[model samples]
Target: MISVVIPVHNEEKNIEPLFREIVAALEPLGEPFEVLFVNDGSTDGTAEVLRRLKERDSRVRVLTMDRNRGEAAALTAGFFHARGEIVASMDGDGQNDPAYLPEMIRRLREGGYAVVSGWRMKRKEPLLTRRLPSWIANRIIGLVTGLRVHDNGCSLKVYRAEVVKRVQIPHGFHRFIPAIFGVKNHEVAEVRILDRPRRFGRTHYGLKRTFEVLRELLTIRFVLGNRVFYEKALLAGGLISGLLAVISLLSSHRPFWAPGAFLGGSFLFFFVWHNLRRFNQAQKEGVFHVRELEI
Candidate 1:
């Protein structure tokens, strides 16, 4: 069984076509599948369309939140409700191709991939706003998290049901899901997917959202880089301690080596303090309480 999760926000016009395409693409696979439409408080006719679709097809399920809780929350709901052996997520803006499902499933099975991410090598978005920021973000993320995925913003990603069963996702951290699992020793693979120009509503993202994603990216990187940072801290502490021991043993006058020992202690203290500041900053912001969930 396979479960497809679609997160939609004000995408009324694209709902029907996306639903039909998913059905057409997945029906021929000769396996049981379910498509979950997570309506993230869309103000358009999206809710009505989903209700109708669910009434018509038993395989179509809708999880409507009381208000817009962003993509991460929506995806979390879908993941909890999904009951397939393989769980997948895609955007509801009609950009991600449903035709790629077969190949994605095949790769997940054959390659023993815990997560199969879809890479859109050729994008139809603008160069500066979308592509440029995305490119910079991908590179920085690759450098930081050591996950060299080309398209971290791509929504066409599939995960094994067992892998995502107890998974927890923070709001706005949806873009870095692969890296989150990747650094934890999960086997994540990528494959090229068709990126079609969206024919429905306009893009909901803006420069503000991009900046927010970048901030979150840095936080994720810092959290993942803790091991190396701590190792360096420990190495520095050990070397300074050993040097101080030797200096004290060989010193004719205590005053000469005392300053160097003080300096080493200061360096170690400053290094640990700086790293602590970063760790504190990486902590998640604010609090969240679920108002309602129909999952």
Candidate 2:
């Protein structure tokens, strides 16, 4: 069985059409599959469309959130609810072709890969607004994570259910799935997929998301480094600050405020490092609240 999870927000016009495409794409595989549409507090009739799809097909399931959580939270909720050995995720905007799912799943199984990500080599979006930022982001992500994934932003990916279920996905971290899986030494593969232009609704992403991606990259780097890296970083900072403090005291015109500020910065680094260690140990439960479940 395969579980295809889609996270949708205010995409009423595209829901039914995308469902039809999914059904057409998956029927040829001749395997039992379930489609899970996670409604991320959509203001439009997206929920109604999902409900209708569920009523028509027993394999359709709907998970409605209490409020508008981001894509990562919605995907997390769907992942938790999915019941299949093979789990797959794709965008709800109809830009991702469902036809490529079978090939991705095949690659995952045949290649013994834990994940098979989609790569839209020739995207259909605008150059400056969409492609440029995505290109920069992909390069930065590859450099930081060392995975060299061609398209980390593509949502069309297949994963082993057991592997993905073990991961704790935080908000705004959905784009780093390849890196997150790679950190655990999981084998990841990518396949070229067709990127269709959006037929309805505006894009949720923009240049602003690029900045958010940059900020989240720091968190990814931190996670990849673990506790030892942070400890070393703090030690280095403390050493630098201490040296500066000594130099200030030894100077003829001692700037007392400079040393105090340097010492304060060192202390601040240690404080954040300590809290981050504690945070890693703490349980992160209930990150997403579901308003309704129709499984």
Candidate 3:
């Protein structure tokens, strides 16, 4: 069975049309499938629309959050409830075409890849506002994570159920799915897909989102890349600084630089210890708690 997970926020107008497109695209594959629409606390009638879709089709499942968490949280919820061995994810804005699902799945299987990401080579959005920011963000993400994909922000992607489910996607980290999977040594393949213009509401992304992506990118580099090496280096610096401070005091000619060095080293050691504790605690907690789930 193939499970398609879509995370939506205030996209009531596009839900029905997108659902029809999904059904049309998947019916030809002759396989069991399920559609999960995660309503991320939209104030509009998005929840009502999703409930209606669920009633109309048995294959449609709706997971409504109690409040607006974020896209990453919504995807995490959908993954927890999804029962398929293979899972596909796309945005609910209708910009992503459902027609590419078959080819993405086919490539995933044939190429022996854990993930098949959609690359929107020719985007239909404005070059200044949407395209330019995405282009710059993708480049920075590639440079930081070392998993260079053409489109890191593309929502249309397919992944093996086990591989994706094991990943810990924090709030606002949905854009880094390919990099997160790559850091764990998962083989990811990219397929060019059609990018359609929005048919309903305004885009949620903008220049502000670009800054947020940069902040999250730094966090990913620290946590997922060479965290242990950094921790050890800080530990050694802290110990050496302490030794110098003690020697300076015992020499009867205390150096003024020793105090500054000791303070800097103490801050570094505290920073590493504090982050290590927080990281361990985060591992034991879920990204988002379940408020309600409807099938």
| Per-residue lDDT of candidate 1, residues 1-295 (tens digit) | 8999998999999999998999898999999999998889889899888888888888888888778878877887788778999998999999998999888999989988888888996788988888888888888877777777878899998888877654356666677777765434358788898789898898987677786675565456544556457545655675666677577767787876675766677565455445434434323332122332332
lDDT, candidate 3, residue 153? 88
Query: Which has the higher lDDT value, candidate number 1 or candidate number 3?
Result: 3
Residue 30 CA displacement from its true place in model 1, Å? 0.6
In order, what lDDT does every prediction score? 0.77, 0.82, 0.81
- Give the clashing pairs for model 2: none
Candidate 2: what lDDT? 0.82
Q: Which ten residues in a row have the lowest lDDT in candidate 3?
A: 273-282
Could you give the candidate ranking by TM-score, starting with the highest?
Answer: 2, 3, 1
Q: What's the lDDT for residue 75 in model 3?
A: 92
Local accuracy of candidate 3 as per-residue lDDT tens digits, 1-295: 9999998999999999999999999999999999999888898999889888888899998887778888988998888888898899999999999999999999989988888889996798989988998998888877878787879889999988887777556666778886765433358888898799999987887778876776566456655656567556656766777777677767767777777777677765656544543443445686666544455
Instruction: Give residue 3's error in model 3 in angstroms.
Output: 0.4
Model 1 lDDT, residue 151, Cα = 86
Segments of candidate 1 deviating more than 4 angstroms: 182-186, 225-295
Candidate 1's error at 124, in angstroms? 1.3
**Who wins the TM-score comparison?**
2
